[model samples]
Target: MSVEVRAVPGESLSFPGRITRVAPPRTHWAPVYRRRVVVADVVAVVGSTLFAYALRFGNAHAHPVQALLLLGLVPVAWLAALFVFRAYERRFMGLGNEEYDRVLQASVFTLALVGTTSWAFQLEIARGYVIIALPLGMFTILLLRYAMRKWLHGQRDRGLHMQSLLVVGHRQGVLAMVRQISRASYHGMRVVGVCLPPAADGRLGVEERALAALGVPVLGGLDEAADVSVSAGVDAVAVLPTPEVDGAFLRRLGWALEETHADLFVAPAVTEVVGPRVAIRPVCGLPLLHLERPELTGFRRLVKGTFDRVASGVGVLVLAPVLVGIALAIKADSRGPVFFRQERVGLEGRTFGMLKFRSMVVDAEARLRDLAASSEGNAVLFKMKDDPRVTRVGRVLRRLSLDELPQLFNVLLGHMSLVGPRPPLAREVAVYGDDARRKLLVKPGLTGLWQINGRSDLDWDESVRLDLRYVENWSFGFDFMILWKTLGAVVRSRGAY
Candidate 1:
């Protein structure tokens, strides 16, 4: 078979198309992850149900002993229901929102089953016990999942529980996938090697140099992907589109990968499209990707605005003492007003005054020109991890994000939401392209995907991409997820600077 392809550039390889073949190390961590989730669910389900049963009927002297015996079996049935939902399956655990969704589904199914049996049998004991236990069990299980996910994420950050990935594709496709996957470590797929498309041209050296920059080893051409994965002990092979790999080729490649015990995946060229907006449908025996138009105007916008105002109003009141203390600290530590105000580009490209507790000296702005050459920020924003202009108290304030507290008032005033795109400066807005201006569809936020993902540390493109994604895929549930994630992001102070 004749194959005309271009090598996807990643990392330089000392042994291109070669990997040491030995008995593969049993390094898979799926068992540990699976076991932990199952144990946590069991504890949550059993403890909540038992506690609910005791609370409801423990003091009732007329309660039959048989009722208690049957009540003890609920946890067993609930555990079985979770397995029935495949909630603890290694494939579904620690990836995306599926785990949590499955947990909720399992709990609901178990409750429904219990209720149905009770009603069908006409049992008198089916009253308040299940009602109390159902909600309690669900809440407890959700909490446990959250805690376990947090712990699992920490492990993944330290290079644990990762799937060894081999990418095969064209130069640009592979590079894009590498960057996207590299930024999202929580996805748990680590790029171990890459297989570029075969090319008989002199540009192979150039391709090698570009792929080498990504720091993953270059492993031969896509034609040898199965052999390469087997030799490298790869857990997954991500097949990206190249001129040579078509539907027929991919079908055979999937079958080939199974011989090496490697899971197969395909990465589409699409980027940052998420939520219900994107779907896959089969028509005429071909899969078609569908993208829905983003909706900006609706009752949801009103609800979001109202949530921002009410939450921020309560926040400002509750944080009054802390705000006042910060004000005093700013006065004592530097020569400036307690609050800093700047004109930021807001919804629909409107300009509004954004407020923050001052975390820099009064001359911070004047010194910007002198420090211009030393800036650590990207094209659209100015940032410095250890700028000399910061006051002593400013350092602590910034690290803990206390300096952002004054933005609550901005939220209360409707100039910003509690979660949306970053509030851009006038200069930043001046440089925005037509497409980037989509970020102005919603109000700027005190915290958003930008804040929770990697505030100042993210590269310019990633930051812009995340904000635009938020704008295009804005939903009430997404906002809630961001708000929930914001607490952990702040506590960890990750990429805050």
Candidate 2:
């Protein structure tokens, strides 16, 4: 492939093609490498299934014929579901938690299919075998994928197996494209240079300076893009849109790249639409992108809510003894009720009394006025890293997060969630600006971004940012991730007390 190199005013030799290269600071790899990683995942799933069977059912007592049949059936069913689900598509293979999610989904679907088929045919499949194999196999496959991802990240960190890209677009588009590619280095792309299309003004925009800060070279204006690509040795050219460029210019740019043997990528202006939600249609030489919203209502919400309640209820039951111990400790250390109830905003701006084990003295609120002047809390809230109101046992409760256990009841009562934005106090909610009010759009959580991030350490702005991001990106999978991280955060207790 061709690439172009150009020297900017103060930057070193700019190989715009080097943006696509796997070296030094850039960690993104070629698209082909990502495809191979998916293939590796398929192999891992098969291998993990076999290993799970061998581990669960020892070779001594295992029925060889039954085992062999199951081994063949498992991989075939998994591969079928994965293919039907389009789980191995290149766009989703490299980054995000979606890859792991698909693997789990495919496994669950395969097991359900197997169960239904066994019952329909009256095949007398051993219940114990099915039970042991499904979960064990699923766990093994997920662990394997996690291990593979870690290795891939390590490779990216070492700057191997990356693609060199040439960004061709208006100044703003080029700057945005470069910034995105740079932030996602694990995707394996390096932008070596940019070719800004010709403008009526003949002067590049301030975004060009932004790109220069990223160290990407600016090849001459758009007309010289193909020549620059050839000299710079870039593998791909990413075409970013500008108001100045119409369909005819884009067509010509495509033809130029084709003659140079460089792969062409067109970035659409659409945002917030994920891969699964988008479909492309080509009609009359025009490419139309069809965006479909994921179904998040009716039965889906019911299922999610039911799962949350059932899971949280079981958790409360399992931790009952620990809860009792914490309550007793709080009582012994201070003269107050076991639980503290405060009015906090819930989903859709509804107010509810959030419950937590009292982690401070009985007169904590009465003393708030005295401590306000010396508060270490964020701008919109009052806090103290070393508040005098906190009891001896309260510190321990805060550190291990045992203080929030009583909120499990709130979750069961449908007033809170096992995961969501932290419930805001009445005063905090009252002062929330228009943008910050978005956090009230979802059900408040016992432990959320604010909880796992820093409980009380995050500034008001950072806390609000995390809350809004959680709302905008809410998904069942995301909730599970936050729950998992909450466990780690609780153990570490960083910035908790």
The best candidate by TM-score is: 1
lDDT of 1: 0.80
Candidate 2 contains a number of clashing pairs equal to 24
What lDDT score belongs to each candidate, Candidate 1 first?
0.80, 0.74
Give me the displacement of residue 14 in model 1, in angstroms.
Answer: 4.8
* Residue 25 accuracy (lDDT) in model 2: 35
Clashing pairs in 1: 9-211, 10-211, 10-212, 11-211, 11-212
TM-score for candidate 1, please give it.
Answer: 0.90
Superposition TM-score, candidate 2 onto the true structure: 0.63
Q: Across residues 1-497, which tens digit of lDDT does each residue of candidate 1 receive?
A: 22223334652244344446422354567787678778888788878777777787677642464365346667888888889998888777776678888888988998888778767876556467778887888888888888777787788888777778888988767877887788788788788778786556535665466656766666767777766667777778898867788888787877777777678988666566777998999879988998888878888789889988999999989999999988998898777688889899999988998998888888889999998888788876778888998889988988899999999998988999999999998898888888788899899999899899888888788788889989989988888889988998889898876
Per-residue lDDT over 205-308 for candidate 2, one digit per residue giving the tens place of the 0 to 100 score: 57766776788777667776666666666777887766756687777777766765467787777543444567888878888887675544578667767987
TM-score for all models, in order of appearance: 0.90, 0.63
